[model samples]
Target: MDALVLFAALFVSVAVGFALGRLSRRHLQSQYPKDYALNYYKGLSYLFNEQPDSAIDAFIGSLEVNSDTLETHLALGNMLRRRGEVTKAIKIHQNLLARPGLNTRQQHESQLELARDYIKSGLLDRAEALLLELVKISSAYKQAALEHLIEIYQDENEWDNAISAASQLDGKHYRPKSGLGLKQLQAHFACEQAQEDMAQRNFSKARTHLQEALGFDSDSARASLLFARLEIHQSRFREALDHLHKIPQQDADYLIEALDMICECYEKIGEPKALQKYLRSLLAEYPSNSLVIKIAERLRWLENDYVAADFIAEQLKQRPSIRTLNRLVELHLPHSEGRAKENLQLLKQLVDRVIEEKPSYCCNKCGFTGNSLHWLCPGCKTWGSVRPIRGVAGE
Candidate 1:
C-alpha cells in the first residue's frame, strides 16, 4: 500500500512538472522575463523526478538572485536546519550572508539563522561566537541567544554561567523567573558546593549549603535527607531525629524514607521501645505499606513471629502490596511444611521479582522513574521531584 502511494505521488509530481513547463514557456518569450520562469520550471522538473540533487542545482541556478529573495533564502535555510539537514541549510544561509547589498536587518537575521544552524549541527564554538556577536547588534535576538547559551551551559554542567543567564532573563516582560527553572539551578549549585565540602570533610560548610537549599525551596526532600545524614555522621542523634521528623512536614510522601533513620537515631539514644511506641502511633495515622513492613520487622525483634505475622496479615488485608505479601511469606517460611513451604518460597520469589522489576521511585513532574533515588530528576532536571512510588507495587 505504501509503495502504491509513493508511485501515485511520483506520477502526480510528473504531471505537475509538465504543466509548470508549459506555463513557464507561455509566460516567458515576451519580455525576456530575466529567465526566472525557465529556471523555475527546470527546478520543478528536478523535484518531480525525485532528484533533490538536481532540484537544488536548478533552484540555485534559477536565482534572479537579488536582495528581494534574501529573506526567502533565509526561510528555506531555516526550514532545512529544522528538518536536521544541517549541511544543506548551512550552504544556503552562508551563501545568503555572503551576498552584497543586504540591509542591516537582513544581515542580522541571516547571521542568527546561520548561528542556529551551527548549534543544530553540534558546532558549539562556532554557534557561540556568532550568537555572542548577534546579541549586541540585534536586540530581538539577544534574549534568544541568552536562552540558547543557558541550554548549552546546563548541558555542560556549568552552573555559574547558567545562574547568570537565568538571573539576567528573570523579572522582565519578555522573561520571568521560571520558578522550577531557577530553583533547580540553585539546588544543583548548592549540591555541587556541598560535594566539595564533603570532599574536604568540612561538615559545617556542607550543612550550610544544605541550609541554603532549604532557604531557596523548603520542600527539598533530598536536602532534608542529606542534612539528617550529616547530623547522624556528626553523632548528633537528637539533631538527626529532629531533621528526620521534619521530612513529613516537608513532604508527607517521603515519610517512609525517614523511618529507618528515625529508628537508628532512637537506638543510638538507647530508646528502642520508646521509638517503637512512637512508630506504632504513626502507623495508626499514616498506615503506609513501608511503615507497616518496618514496624513488622521491629515487632519480630521485640516480640515473636506470631505477633509480626498477624500484623502483616492485618495490614495486607487493608492495603495489599507485593512487598508486604513477600514479607509475610518470609515470616511463614520457617514454620511451614513440605509442599506448602516450597510453594511459599516460589511465591516469595515471584513477588520479589515483581517488586525488583518495577522502579522504586518516580518523578511526579516529569514522569521519570528509576530504582534509585535522585534528588534532581535526571530526565527533567527538576530538584526534589523524584520521589518514592506510593501504591500497590510501590512503598
Candidate 2:
C-alpha cells in the first residue's frame, strides 16, 4: 500500500512537470515546444514500460534550466535518488545548491537533497556534515535531519551520539502513533551501554545502566530481562525473581522469556516446590506449549516417566506440538529396546534437527531472526524489539 501511494505521487509529479514544461516552452518558436512535449511523452512511455533508468535520463534531458523549471529539476533529481541513481541525483542536487539566485529555504532544501544523495552513495562523512548543518538551521526538516543523523550513528555504532540525536528531535512533530520516538530511542542507548558493561563482566555497572533504561521507559522489557539475568548471575535470586515478574506487566507477550530463567533462580535458591507452584499457576493462566513442556520436565525429575508421559499427553491434546511429541517419545524409549527404541531415537534426532535450525530470537519490528539475543536489532537498528521465540521449536 505504501509503495503504491509513493508510485502514484511520483506519477503525479511527473505529470505536473510535463504540464509546466509544455506551458513554459509555448512562448518559444516552431519545433521547440513540439520536441519538448514529444520527449515528455517518450519519458512517460519509458517509465510505464519499466525502463525507469532510461526514463530518468530522458526526463532530465527534456527539462530546460530556467527559474520556472528549477522545481521540476529538483523533483527529477529526487526521483533519480528514489530510483537508486545516486550519482545522477547527486550531480543534479549539487548543481541546484551551487545556483546563485536560490532563496534561503530553497538552498537548505537543496542541501538536504544533496545530503540524502551522499547517504545513498555511501559518503557517510559528507552526509553527516550536511545533516549536522541542517540540524542547526531549525527548519521543520530539522526532525528529518535528526532522524538521518541517528541512522548514521547507528551504522557507525556510536550509541552515545545516536542517543543525543534522537533526543534532539521534536517527537510531537512526527506522526503520533509511530513506536520509534525519543523515549524508545533513549532506552535503546542505555541498553547498548548495559550490553558493553555485561561484556566487561561489570555486573553492577550493567545493572545501573539497565536501571536508567527502565527510568527512561519503564515498559522496556529488554531492560527488565537484562536486569533479571544480571541478578541471577550475582546469586540474588529473590531480586532476579522480582525483575522477572516485571516482564508480564511490561509486555505480556514477553512473559515466556522470564519463565526458564526464573525457574533456574528458584532451583538455585533451594525452592523447587515454589517454582513448581508458580509454574502450575502460570499454566492456569497463560498456558504456553513451552511452559507445558518445561513443567513436564520438572514432573519427570520429581516423580517418574509415567507421570511425565501422562502430563505431556494431556497437554498435547490441548495444544498439539512436535516438541511435546518428541518429549513423549523419549519417555517411552527407556522401557523399550530393539527396533522400537531405534525408531524413537531417529525421531528424536529429526526433532533435534528441526529445533536446531530454528532461530532462538526474532525482532518484532524488522523480522530479523537469529540464534542469540540482540538488545538492538541489527537489521533496523531499533531497540528492545528482538525477543525470544516461543512455540514448538523455541523457548
All candidates' TM-scores? 0.74, 0.81
Alpha carbon lDDT at 170, candidate 1:
44
Q: Please state every model's RMSD to the true fold in angstroms.
A: 5.7, 5.0
Model 2 TM-score on a 0 to 1 scale: 0.81
lDDT of 1 by residue, 42-114 (tens): 8667666766656655565455335555645665666667667789778878877787778877787788888
Which lDDT values do the candidates have, in the order given? 0.75, 0.79
- For model 1, what is the C-alpha lDDT against the true structure? 0.75
Per-residue CA lDDT of model 2 for 172-240, tens digit only, reads 875422265678777878888898899999988898889888988888877888888898888888998
- Model 1 TM: 0.74
CA error at residue 371 for candidate 2, angstroms? 4.0
| CA displacement after TM-score superposition, residue 356 of candidate 2 (Å) | 4.0
Alpha-carbon shift of residue 369 in model 2 (angstroms)? 4.1
